[model samples]
Target: MRLFFGLDPLAGDKRAIDSWRQRVATADGRPVPPANFHLTLAFLGEVDERHLEALCDTVDDLALPGTGELRLDRVGYWPRPGILWIGPAAPQPALESLAGDLGRAGQAVGARRERRRFVPHLTLYRGCRVPPPAPAEPPDLPFRFRGVTLFESRRGRDGIRYEPVAAWEGGGFSQR
Candidate 1:
């Protein structure tokens, strides 16, 4: 199955992100559905079913630290990937550390370590024929991450959809 670890934003945050996308996305760009909006922590490509249990176990044992409210205030466009994304203006140490821990857990289960450094962002649009111009400034949206989820990616009638398979709650403490 195609799997990844991620965090889903609250409903209000999703609406704010969608609103921003409507403002800057080009006609040719496909906006990510609000229901599919999430901040990916680790992308574990195709995986064998046999390894799934071990992967889950690894994540269950992660030592995640408490993080304060996260802000998705910066809008950015990556020309190479033709993706529009929203992210924080500055580095979020707690969020970064959680991603690192998740990455290590994936590696322990034979998942490939990503070569690029993790940049915390939620995709707003993808496959833009013409990249949208960067916004002059970011919108103000603040939220707390409630949990980390294991998601299975699959092709659906509309397009690719990410469905949550399992999750671990986070609220200034670790949860299995």
Candidate 2:
């Protein structure tokens, strides 16, 4: 099974993001679905059942801190122009450190971590469609991330269906 780790955006914030999705989709003559929003941390390729269990153990062992009360207030797309996401507001050090750990830990288990490095953003839409030309502006929307979730993506009839496998509380990391 294919697996990946990521931070899920709040449902309320997602409602705001869906507005942008609608605009972009309408511009492209299609309707972008809102059920596909997510902020990926690490993309782990195909894994056997045991390996999947190992990944869960890795997550449990690492116990990466969540980004408590984090902000995501910018919108943008990848260089290739296939995905649109909301960028975090200069991720806190703890958030960065936690992302680093998530990447490294995934690598430790033979997962291919992104080479461009993690920027921490919520992926609004990603598929075969070209992203609408970069927004000449930002959403200027303010929202908080109070939790994170791991998801599994499977291609469905309409598009990829993302199912939540697990979630962690306390988003921005613990002070300890």
> How high is each candidate's TM-score?
0.87, 0.75
User: Where in model 2 is the C-alpha error above 4 Å?
Assistant: 20-32, 89-91, 127-137, 170-176
Q: Give the number of the best model, judged by lDDT.
A: 1
Residue-level lDDT of model 1, residues 1-176, one tens digit each, is 88888888888878877776676544457778998989988888877878888887777777643333578888777776778888888987777888888888888877878777889888888887776765654566775566788889999798999988877774423332
Question: Which pairs clash (backbone N, Cα, C closer than 3 Å) in model 1?
Answer: none
Top TM-score hit: 1
lDDT of 2 at 44: 68
lDDT of 2 by residue, 1-176 (tens): 56677766677767877875555432342334656666677776665555555565566656555444456667666646566567666756666677777667667767777677667776665542655665654565545555556677788787667877766664323211
lDDT of 2: 0.62
